[model samples]
Target: MKGQLILLDHLTGPDGPVEAAALMRDGRLEDLFIDSDAPRPGAIYRAKADRPVKGQGGMFLTTPDGPAFLRQVKGLSPGAPLLVQVTGHAEPGKAIPVTTKLLFKSRYAIVTPGAPGINVSRQIKDDETRDALLEIAHDTLDGHPIHDHEGGLILRSSCAEAEGDAVAEDIAAMADLAVQVLNDAEGEAEKLTEGDGPHAMAWREWVTPAQIETEAGCFAHHGVHEKIEALFRPEVALGSATVFIEPTRAFTAVDVNTGADTSLAAGLKANLALARDLPRQLRLRGLGGVVILDLAPMPKKDRRSFEGALRAALKTDDTDTVMAGWTPLGNYELQRKRARQPLTDIVTEEMLQ
Candidate 1:
């Protein structure tokens, strides 16, 4: 059988490394790796002939020494970077097959193939081709007609043990689940569309230009006065700050410091203070979308501490605020949910005024 095989990173966390497996018959998650703690979910795991194996379709095993074994296998096929299989024997006569293969160049053991003595070919290396095969397996199991596209070849799952019919049936069930999810999403969208117009109408009474200017004035007086005042008077030689209301949305992007400030720390601190008070402005402005606060770079420790403060300040906002953490370039991104138009959108006052 051919399908996209996702080898999850070995689970390592607080509870300690948990052994997990995910069986996707088609595109849908079929049977998850059953931990020792929980029972099997459905017929998929129930029908298993033998207990789940660790390496390749056999037992629960982790081999620190297996990498060395894999290296030996790779040596056999010199210059061929894509594929290799390693076999080890647990006991004499019965050779232990510790199959180590690369999925997208990352090595992962194929623990279960659904059957024995299955031969894997080189074609499984191509991810696109593998996915198509799994799709075919799923469609066939569901008794659906194989879709006709450019190359009309039916693909199968990589697991050799699964019977042709079993693979097809699993895929069909996945397709059915997908259809249900899409239908539910579409229904939700329709409800939102029906309710949107009335919601916008309700905001018209409270969101006004005067309210926006008042809020802007408050932000200027307390947070960043020079930058805020500069917005109202274009002729003023101020360090770069551009405030504009985004059209067709309830969000406003107030960019601080377009021009370089002589003191980098001061500029960053100014930006941080502006970011810290954004939630109140969002309430006053009725704007949202994790306000992207692009700040000047500061020390790493200070940046983290500032981020903590920004998050704490946002908590005062009744609306939802999510801190999206910092970027590699040291910009802080904050997401604040706004229910209505911001004060700035209602007001069209020019900087000169």
Candidate 2:
């Protein structure tokens, strides 16, 4: 455990350089991040409202990068310039999904404009630590002209282990950036902030102390390439059971199989195992959207335990996911946010070739 490693490297493709990060635990690839040129989910932009779709309750907006779609356009008029943040990766040839609510997130704090309140992450259960972080947040933001007090600060769980000065600096820096970007909103369709790359993201999100590797070809040295390539295939072996994850044009399909296990509880065991690993599988593949899970033939009575395991797994995952319950045919469904570019789509075919 002390020897866990985070490897950061770059891969060249037809599009240009793609930044990559891989987390290795006990000599196995545990997580991965690959950058893409597509519009990132957290990027903020000053966009001009385009024509509203007559049928859909959303309107298309023009950003410097490309067209973006924003829902609930009741107050926005055509040609009006407003701030928006990219909400998710767009489907092929579709407008990038965006929202008017902007959030500036950093390693230690999240600054929310138009939502004023100083809140601390619930993960820090220590009363003394929470009070200390709240005091730091107030000290950093007390007199700052952040959106005329409409800006709120959220001290992230990372602050628990971080130095007070560092946490305060992160909060102050994000608050200042939010104010600056908001003040500069009276302009053409322009990107206010570029999304963080893989290396930066690894630094921010992978807060657990680990051996960091930045040498070139580190991915190849650590066998990350092979692990990633294996994901191109559908089957992932979990002990004697296997989980198959295949993405389609509309949704991702997941199937659980109990390999040669003839025990009565084989189906229930496989389903529970897949439920724990499903989040990591989807996250590494960067596949999101509708997820249809076809679990092995488990007794209906065991569905509650299966759901509990799945919910617990997803609760710890960073991605937003909602379990939509079981279908008539005993299949389960999940709706996951498209927070990253799909691994297959981002890795160029030529590179694989």
- TM of each candidate vs. truth: 0.29, 0.96
> Candidate 1 — which residues are off by over 4 angstroms?
1-254, 258-261, 344-353
Tell me the tens digit of each residue's lDDT in model 1 across 1-353: 23533222223324553332322223322222212221111101001011233354233222222211222231222222221222211221232233333111101111121121212334357666555445544344343222211112223223333345544454454334323322332211111111112112222112111212222233223222233233333131223433232323333344555344566576556556655655544554445654655554466767766767777877555567777777676666666543433333332333212
lDDT of 2 by residue, 293-337 (tens): 999998899999999999999987899998899899989999999
In Å, residue 35's CA in model 1 sits off its true spot by 55
Error of 2 at 243 (Å): 1.9
Clashes of 2: 0
Stretch of 10 with least lDDT, candidate 2 = 344-353
The models' CA-based lDDT, in order, is 0.35, 0.89
